[model samples]
Target: MEFRHLGRSGLIISEIAYGNWLTHGSQVEQETATACIRAALDAGITTFDTADVYAETRAETVLGQGLKGERRAGLELLTKVYFPAGPGRNDRGLSRKHIMESIDGSLRRLQTDYIDLYQAHRYDHSTPLEETMDAFADVVRSGKALYIGVSEWTAEQIRAAHALARELHIPLVSNQPQYSALWRVIEAEVVPASEELGLGQVVWSPIAQGVLTGKYLPGARLPASTRARDDKGGAASVARWLRNDVLERVQQLKPLAAEAGLSLAQLAVAWVLQNSNVSAAIIGASRPEQVTENVKAAGVKLDAGLLKRMDEILTPVAMFDPAITAEASPQTRP
Candidate 1:
């Protein structure tokens, strides 16, 4: 596996990471989860990302059990705070109380003394950005978090945090956002802001939540075991008409991948990592076999011609500026 600096920090992370957003807690049993984590480690995936809100808070514990003993030492574990963990008024957002209280639980659940990176899951409209930054800075100061980052933040919000971190002399490392062949809003603004801020992007949804994998097809039923099949919350409904066209576009890439001697998945991942600014592509998988395929993609650097071919594959749809920016990408790992 290739390694990259985790957003200009001295800390090095694997080029392809295994994250537990859905599979560990929602889809797989402990046995399968153990195998998947082992597959990632064996493939040299050093990072494992989870969140406080995933699988009703069971993903972390599953990941903890999965990464026991000698294996734990080889991983850079990351988790996020600020989400509705419960029905209480104080159960969500980036309040200091929540931030402080949440990390301890995450640590315990992750079975670690310190998280390699801790991120705000989303932008909290109610909390002051400075307050959030100060609270995050404290996490680094207290040694509970090795680095601080934000997920799916707007360009302005990222700029605000970057400026505040500078004024306060706090080091903010990365921004996790959705970037894929099918979705390119980050290319417009967030990517530029992140570049200016000396922060690297560890992009999530690099495959458009499986759309880029060429799963759904025109005039076909939803795959019984995919994210789109599990979409009861209007997620699958958001791009009903557009998705068919996108899937058709993905089908065109199969021949390109065939000629390149790579799977379409590898081609998609390599396309995301093609940009120099990307630190790593977070690869989440349901089965252990998927980890190997995804990890190989990290090394499949696409040439300029291949990228142009890929653009032709997607056919340039209108940009997707998501509200919530990150949807936990449910079945995201699956």
Candidate 2:
């Protein structure tokens, strides 16, 4: 597996990070989840990303079990906060209370004392940014987490946080955002800001939640057992890319994938890694073979011309508006 330094930080992580978002502890059985994690490790993936809120905190336990025998020093484990992990008013957001309590809970669930990179799952409009960053600083100082990051944060939010992170002398090294060939919202604003601030992007949904895999054909009935048919949150997460227009446009990339000698999914994953600022592309899987297949994109380099053709085909349907980044975060805590 190819490895890159996460942002300007000294920490090196695998380019292909295996993430359990909708699969582990929810859509797939624990056995399947562990098998996928093993597959990722077999394929040389050392980075694992999860969240405390995934499957209401069960995902971390499953992941912890999956990594039981592995040397902790060899893996880069990442998780997030700021989502409602519990029912109480004090159970969520980036407030000092929640951050302090949540870190201990995550450490317990993850079966690790120190998270490699702990992130804010989303921006908390209700909490002061200073309170959040200060809490993160304490988490680092306490040695519960090595570095801190934020997910789906706007460029301005990132800039403000980076200034505070510098002031606090903590390593705020990465930004986790939804990025893929179909989702280019981060390119216009977030990328530039993060690049300037010494932050790298560990992008999620590099295949647009399987839309870029060409599995959902235009006008076709929802494929049996596919993400679109999932009753779980997967369906809603991938709903925007299931439109006929988007599906039809996605189909045009088949020949390009063939020419590049890559599966549609590999093409999609590699497309994101082509950006210099992207440190890693997060891929989630229910099956072990899927993990093996997608990891091939790790060190694959796509020519500039092939990338251009992909853009021409997908640009019309792609969501590139910079405003979309800000829109992605909730105005108030959920």
Candidate 3:
């Protein structure tokens, strides 16, 4: 797999990162999740991203078991905090207590002494940014985490945090945002600010949660066993893209993908990677073959003309409003 340096940091990561968000420990069986991880490794993926909040912390344990025997030095493991991982009031947010405690818990669950990149899952409005950054600083100094980042943070939030991170001498190298051909919210503001701040993007949902795979046809019934029909959070997460307008627009890109000799999913993933500031695209899977199929997007270059055609087809339905980033985050801790 091709690799890129995250932001201006010295640490390099695989372009296609294996992520377990809604699948492991929740939707998919542990055996299937483990097989997907193995498939990712077999496809030369060395980066893995997860969160303590995923499946109420079970995702990390499953991932740890999946990577149990791999050489730790060869993998770039990433996890996040700032969500309610527990019932207590202090069990969430980016408060010093949560950051400190979360790090240890994540390390324990992941079966690793240190995490390569520890991110704030969302901006914790209730906590002072200073407190959060200071806690992250301590986490790095203590060697529990090597670098720090934020997810779904606004450009203004990123700028403020970057200043604080710089003052504290921390390596705030990346932001994890939901970015895809159909979700261009990060392009307008977040990308420019992150570029200025020396932060690379490790984008998630590069296929718009499978909407861009051309599986959900317009005017069609919800496909059996698809994410749109999932009773779990997946259904809600993908609900916005299930509309006929969006689904119909997605269908127009299928031929473009075919002309590029890529599956719809590969085109979607490659579309995101075309951004020079995007260091990696996070892909989640329920089956091992899905992992194998999506990883082909890695190192695949789409011509400018094909990319232009893709934009023309998807732009009308794409969500590009910069405010969506802040709206997606909790105004107060959940």
Candidate 4:
């Protein structure tokens, strides 16, 4: 796989980075997780993304155990913070206290001297942006983190942080937002902002959490291992995702995927790579075969005509209402 600069940070990461979302420490057992990471490395995926809050903070330990020897140097390791890891009020957010304390915990769990990319998993509106920015600036300067990023933030908020980083002489490298054939909301604001600011867009959920993989077709039984099955959300969110119309659109991508000598997952992943704004796509796979399939997606590129056809099939909605924020989608239903 080719490499790209994570924003302007000078850190090189593989275009198809492996992410351990629900796989490591949640859905898959430790031995299985180890096998999956090795498979991704064998496929030239040098970047491995995980988070402190993923699997209630056990995922990092699984990754640490997997890449203990020569494998450690072969990767750009990433993990995130700013999610609730404990019941205490200070257990979350991007506060200085939390950022400082959390990195040590993450380092211990990830078994790394320093994280390649330390990101805020979500924006903390309650925390002062400057306080958060200053804390992150310290994370890099002190060598605890190589680079810093934020997830699910809007262009305006990104700009605010960027300016603060500039003022403080700190470099914020990238943003990890969800982008896929079915999710182009980032195209509305975040993409343009990131491009203009020289921040690379290392996107997550390029397949819409397996929706674009065409695995959940209309009338098909929900797969036992799919995110829908593992969803940690309200019933409303789950029910909306299971809608027939949504599944029909996902099913439409099957033949298109076959024509490309790929699975729908690959086609969906490749589609994200079609945009230069996308620095990389974080692909999380439950099994080694899924990693293999996703790795091949780097070789598949959709042409303009095919892209148009895809647009027609998925009917991509611009999710970022300038009136709304890039991090939060407009409410879909009551």
Candidate 5:
């Protein structure tokens, strides 16, 4: 596995990160999750990503158990905040109280003393960015987390946070965004903003949530036990990309992958890694073999011609609107 420095930070992470978003704690059995984690380790994946809100907080526990006996120093463990982890009014957002409490809970559940990277899952329009950044700075000073990041944040939000992060002497090193051949929403503004700020991207769903893998064919039956069938929520997330036209277009890439000697999945994953600013691509799996297959994208460079052809094939259906990254307006309290 090839490694890259996260942004300008000194921390080096595997190019293929093992992520348990919809798999652990909800979709897969614990044993399956453990085996997948083991498979990732066997494939030389040292970076792991999860979130406090995933599976209502059970994902972290499952990941902690999966990583049991692994040397902590050798792994780059990451998790997120800014989602509702509980029912109480104080249980969510990037508020200082919630951030302070959530860090301890995540640390406890993750079975780790320090999080390699702690990210804001989404921009908290309700909370002052300063309060959030201050809380993150505190997390760094307290040694509960080593670095800070934000996922799905707009370029404007990122710039504002980076300003504060610099003022506070906190290292905001990475941005975790849903980036793939089908989803190019981050490329226009977020990538340039992050590049200017020295932040690298740890992209998720490089396969467009299996759409780019060509498993969900146009007008075909939804395969049993696939992500679209097993994860209604995830299926909904990928539903837009599941249109007949998109699926038919995706099928055209099979020959390209064949020419490159890569599976459709590997092509999708490698496509994201081709971006110089992308530090890693997070891949989720329910089985160990899936992990093994996807990680092969690591350190594999696609030919320039093949990449150009891929763009020609996917550009018409690709969503590159910068507006997709716009932050939602602040929700008013009643």
Candidate 6:
């Protein structure tokens, strides 16, 4: 696997990171999740990503058990906060109480004394940015977390946080965003802003949650066991991309993928890595073979002509608005 420094930081991580978002401890059986993680390790992946709110808090525990025997010093493990983890009114957001409690909970569940990177899953509009950064600065000072990052944060939020992180003498190294050939929301503003702030992107869903794999045919019924068929939230999340126009356009890219000697999934993952500011692309897997198939994109480079053709085919249906990064409606937590 090829490694890249996360932003301007001295940390080097695998270009293809193994992530367990919807799969571990929820979608698949424990055995299947463990096998997928083992396959990633066999392929030389040194980075793993998870979040505290995934599966209502079971994903992290499953990941910890999966990595029980591995050499912890050889891996870069990451997790996130800022979402509700319980029914209590103070169970969520980036408040000092939440951050302090959440880090301890994560350490216990993840079976690790320290987290390589701890991210704010989303911007907390209810709290001051300084309060959140201050809590994170304490995390770093205590050596519970090595670096800080934010996900789906707008350019303005990133700039503000970066300034605070610098003042606090903490390392804010990366941003995790949903970036792919079809979803270029970060390109117009976030990329440029991150470049200026020395933050590299560790992108998620490079295949658009399986939409870019050409498996969901435009006119066909949703494939059984596929993400689109999942009744538990995953289907609802990807419903917008299930449109016939988007599916048809995705199908047109299959021949181009063949010409480049790649699976449609591999082509999609490699396309995201083409950007110099993207340090890694996080890929989720349900089966071991899926992990093996995606690792092929690690060092592959797509030619300029192919990339141009891909844009020409997909631009009509692409979502590139900078507003896509805006904060969501505040949740009514307990």
Model 4 lDDT per residue over 1-334, tens place: 8787787667788999988887788788799999898898899999989999888899999998988884566688999988877778788888888888999999999888999888988777778889998999888899888788888888888889899989988778899987877767778788889888888888888877767777777887887755676555222334555778878877877787778788888888999998887779999877888898788988566878888888887774323354344435222200
lDDT of 5 by residue, 31-51 (tens): 999999999999999999999
- lDDT digits (tens) for residues 122-240 of candidate 1: 88877877888888888888989888888888778888888998887777888887777776777767787888877888888777777777777877877677776665322464344
Per-model TM-score versus the true fold: 0.92, 0.99, 0.99, 0.92, 0.97, 0.98
Model 2 stretches astray by more than 4 angstroms: none
TM-score of 2: 0.99
Colliding residue pairs in candidate 4: 7-200
Compare candidates 4 and 5 on lDDT and give the better one: 5
| Worst 10-residue lDDT window, candidate 5 | 325-334
Worst lDDT run of 10 residues, candidate 6, spans 325-334
Cα lDDT of model 2 by residue, 1-334, tens digit = 9999999999999999999999899988789999999999999999999999999999999999999989999999999998999999989888999999999999999899899999999999999999999999999999999999999999999999999999999999999999999889999899999999999999999999889999998888888988888878488889988899999988899999999999999999999999999999999998999999999998999998998999899999998898988877788888
For model 6, residues 1-334, the per-residue Cα lDDT tens digits are 9999999999999999999999998998678999999999999999999999989889999999999989999999999998989889899998999999999999999999999999998888888889999999999999999999999899988999999999999999999999999899999999999999999999999999899988999999997888888877488868989999999999999999999999999999999999999999999999999999999999999999999999999999999998878843253322
Clashing pairs in 2: none
Candidates in order have lDDT scores of 0.79, 0.94, 0.94, 0.81, 0.92, 0.93
- What TM-score, to 2 decimals, does candidate 1 have? 0.92
Residues forming the 10-long window of minimal summed lDDT in candidate 3? 228-237
RMSD after CA superposition, every candidate: 3.8, 0.8, 0.8, 3.1, 1.5, 1.2
What is the RMSD of candidate 5?
1.5
Best of the two (1, 2) by TM-score? 2
